[model samples]
Target: MNPSKTGLSFLWLSAVAFIADLATKYLVVTRFALYESIDILPFFNLTYVRNPGAAFSFLANHSGWQKIFFIVLAILISAMLVYFLFKNNAAQKLQNAAYALIIGGALANAADRAYHGFVVDFLDFYWQDWHYPVFNVADIAICVGAGLLALDAIKNGDKKKSEKKA
Candidate 1:
């Protein structure tokens, strides 16, 4: 419940996640060719792809304006996540993890936007001929963090109900 502890935990998680994301992106950029696919498993593969747009290549076609808009959005979201970390009880691990995950992913993608004007995606999943959209570490962090946050909410809600009945 201590503010310092929460802030420290958040910083630790964010730093680790950010570093990992950056390292992975660097590896992918240096080692893989654009649109090249490396099969990692029967149902998964690492396929290098650059997405100038948002998730699932949304607005991938519009080149000029959408880039700036998405960059601004990512920055705003990162700022909001930081604010949430400061305002909420960071002592709660799940809440802290959620904030850290968001910050890390936002930072990773923002870095990509600044450097390359696009985000590097590689991870892919498929069943036979059906393939899912390729994604990267940042997207993974966002999804995992969101799931954790959702679970935390349900847990806290149950706690509140139990207290009310007692």
Candidate 2:
């Protein structure tokens, strides 16, 4: 199959990811109480937490301006991602996937912020006395997408160098 054709498929992946993120957030909100924790394993738990700011609760302590800031920022970023996805060549499958994932995740979180003034988080991982920040499906998508983009950059760079030597 042509790699360039993969870009269109990535758009579908974005839709699926957005829907899944919304579905999971709905379940968590309806079934769990705020700050409630349910142990699923020795190292993981479902913990309900609201983040009004960016990752790691950045700017969460501010006087509520961050909510508006993040909502607008997410919208802008998502638009940019969509533009990039369309502009990207078909052979850049990984890059297209990266754009799709980031766009989907951004929209999901932005929806939450618009409706609830914060993002709903539930998945939690911890060990012994240390605990990682709670997150949700949207966060996962964004992180994975960003990683893929980085990998694509490195791979493309290598390809260019190889071509130059030939």
Predicted structure 1: lDDT? 0.85
For each candidate, what TM-score against the reference?
0.92, 0.93
* Reference-based lDDT, each prediction: 0.85, 0.89
Model 1 / residue 124 / CA error / Å: 1.0
Task: Compute the lDDT of residue 55 as modeled in candidate 2.
Answer: 96
lDDT per residue as tens, model 1, 28-50: 99998899889889999999999
Q: Across residues 25-128, which tens digit of lDDT does each residue of candidate 2 receive?
A: 99999999999999999999999999988899999889999988888898899888777776677778889989899888988998999999999999999999
* Model 2 residue pairs with clashes: 4-90, 4-91
lDDT of 1 at 107: 81
Instruction: Check candidate 1 and list the clashing pairs.
Output: none
Supply the TM-score for candidate 2. 0.93
